[model samples]
Target: MMNSRDFHRSPSFTERLSGLSTAFKMFPFIQTGQRILQPFLEKFGFSVQEVTDSVKLFLTNGHPALTFPFLRPPNNILIGCANLLGSKSAPLQFSPQISQFLNESVGKDVVYVSFGPYVKMSGVSWYSQLVEILTELDLRVIVKVDKEFEKEFPKSVLPLNWAPQKDLLRSGKIKLFISHCGNNGKMETIYYNVPVLCIPQFADQPVNAELVKVKGFGESLMKEDISVRAKEVIAAMIANHGTYHRNMKRASDIVENEPGNARENLLYYVEQVAEMGNVDYLVNKVARQQSTVEMYNLDIVVPVVVIVIVVVGFILYVLLKFCVYFSRKVGMAGFRKLKNE
Candidate 1:
């Protein structure tokens, strides 16, 4: 009784009701439902093959499927700010304005703190407690306070809404980072080869925190008893400087060695796909050939030759033009001399 487009546009009453019911339920129920439905859908030809193929492609390209790519085998995932070869290890630089203040306050013993952007300090009472404990320690603190806590903390606390985090980490002035254990921050700390005191809020944070402890980079504190835990953890971090530095160095090495820049790798893959007309076999073959050519230094030779030729041609053209102009001038000068004679 309806056109095809109209029929497709209209959601079934049953589906609408089901969606409404799901919305009213708790978050856990929605997650449970998704988990249950995912396997069923995959089995019923929803996305099984596509998912498998995509994962295979990533793995084949030297990417890790689970865990931080910078942490484990294949060792081709790029996720840090340091050079992998460790050829040029240097201290991180912080904003000059804050650096002066930090140097004056803590001298060579300052602590950096960040709980990530999403984790609000207002909703978490432990933030205030942690601040108080850090202040009591008489340590110079660079705490990245969220918008909610901006007015709450005193001006002298070095409270920042956002910071040049990587630069600060690389700065030798920062002795420790109190983090939420987010992967980016974790990787940054690793790249800077700095120790961390993780205060996990939720999600993968607990897992990351555990890994940090396991890897000996640093320790984690309970979010609830932030003050007490932070005090103990900070003491531990300061005392056991050797282990943290060593672990961070090792992590930095791995991160630096990871294969492929995200942009470069992604564009390479996309270009490959387009060039090969989406033929998987052809794409693989082309990639293999390109790798071989690169290894053998074959592809570079032609481009270098072309560049040289172009440069030489330009120089020759200019020289020829100069010669032609001089010849014409000489010819005119001889004629004028003869006429004058």
Candidate 2:
């Protein structure tokens, strides 16, 4: 359920450094939380970190394009296939109003906007501004908001508390998605090959939003800047729609045809453990047995680092000694020659 990058082993050096710095900065808050929870967790016989460490397997629901494309996870970890590729027998039924709106907007590009259920924009100052911008766009617009806010927008726009998001994205009429960039929404858009205009609110949404841009399937804007930049960003994405389409289409193809099937992988592992009656072979014994120091290779790292420093120090000492000896000898010889002259 975590972002794949959190578990990814081989990040670029700069990214690794940045992660290390973040860990350091957050260490104090982490320690404080641990201290507050230590007494309560002692009753359960393990700490917070131990919960994840004790797990025998981690099943992630995403394609390798969003996970580790070039590398495989350890035996204990399984990258499950994208959920969109799974069962879709019961498709979401759209309301009559929404259905009619889609029908009338035929032959025109549609933009689907939803911030997800968790985020409420009713109190935000920019909500009205966003509605105004949506009203002005010539493209057909479908926005998901509370029913109370529905009256704020013109009749041309359709505002519902909920939208058949997956169905609409799959409808092919939706050329762009305006989203808060939640993980599930991002994956759905990717599955549907629709470009996104991300205005992330918080948490993993920002990370997902950045990846949208990095993957070249979309662009991102800060939530605060949306009131000012939303119109321009939307127009630009629509103008360059082809490039985004191609990028997302490639991703969709990879997820559908990726070498290891996500569902199959999960089922196989479960069946294996059930038949064997234990995960002995699957578990990394050394990893589980090791303390934090050894787990990070800090035990080995510290000594190796000390050895390197000592070796370099010894080399510098010898070089200095030789230089001093040579200089003295040359100076003495010159003095003797001068005395003779």
Candidate 3:
């Protein structure tokens, strides 16, 4: 059901921010110290007031924004809801499929390559470079390319139009993931405890890639350097597999320990938003808080008062000059009359 048209009709920045603010209002605990920026929505001429109104409507109407499956409640407030499949209780059915593929391989050295659902390799020049790099590497590759590019790849590169990615990752054969850094791909990589080589193309992919680096899960490569970087990173990942595995296991454990199921988390926030009705209370609370105190705060207030005083003094000076000129004219007229008499 998701198509190019649906993708192109993506929500504006204002809409996204408003939705996030509403989510935050619904669950204030989700707000980390980090500021959430919604400038893109504002750039399109959406005022903060208008965005707030819309968010109010969405919350009151019981139409919380669609979220991902893996997201749990307080986590949802912070991370927003993930797709349904991403839920914590979601079955680990995909892992076995990947395991079967790995069992067929002679060694436990395999690379998983996927550009994600939204991205395709049919016309992209990088596809050929990726193929060339994988051919040179000492590992088997399981690639998920567009159906159109199936014939272009070699036999060693196990090409599928659409592969069971989650299953494949859990198969234990996959040594590293050459990914486009999609959320689903990132989560799957984390869930299966697989190391990644992120090649982010657009949207929140760069953010996800940064997260990967921060988490010590893997390296990020520029799309332009797919050929050279892929080979190098792949070699490094293979060489440091033990470290990668350790980091991945740690991340998985952290995710697993989080409280509540993804659905329970999502519904809890949604119910909270319904109860709160609007973001007015949250916004007011934030506005009233003093971020920091400054000694020169009073000095800033004094300048406006000084400017007003100067403007009023100038006006009075002009009025007095006009009165003097009129009085002098009248006196001169009287003196003229006396001389005539």
Best of the candidates, lDDT: 2
lDDT (C-alpha) at residue 128 in model 2: 63
Taking all chains together, the TM-score of candidate 3 against the true structure is 0.59
What CA RMSD would candidate 2 show? 8.6
* Candidate 2 runs further than 4 Å off: 1-48, 67-82, 86-92, 288-341
Q: What's the TM for model 2?
A: 0.69
Arranged by TM-score with the best first, the candidates are: 2, 3, 1
**Mind giving the per-residue lDDT tens digits that candidate 3 earns over 43-109?**
6887554664445322111111211222121111332223323444555564454545566766648
Could you report the Cα RMSD, in angstroms, for every candidate shown? 23.8, 8.6, 17.2
Q: Kindly report which residue pairs in candidate 2 clash with one another.
A: 81-262
Q: Quote the positional error of residue 85 for candidate 1 in Å.
A: 8.9
Q: What is the C-alpha lDDT of each candidate?
A: 0.62, 0.72, 0.61
Task: Estimate, for each residue in 126-192, the C-alpha lDDT of model 2 and write its tens digit.
Answer: 7667767766778778888865563566656888888888888887789899898987888888777
Tens digit per residue, CA lDDT, model 1, 1-341: 11223323333434334443333333343344346446777766775435433542332222222122232112122323422234235555567778677767654567888888766776566777787777777677788877766446554468888887877877666778889988778766766778988887766577678767866788888887674467877877887877888877775655456566444555665576577655344222222233444423334446767999999999999999999999999999999999999
TM per candidate: 0.56, 0.69, 0.59
In model 2, state the lDDT of residue 261. 64
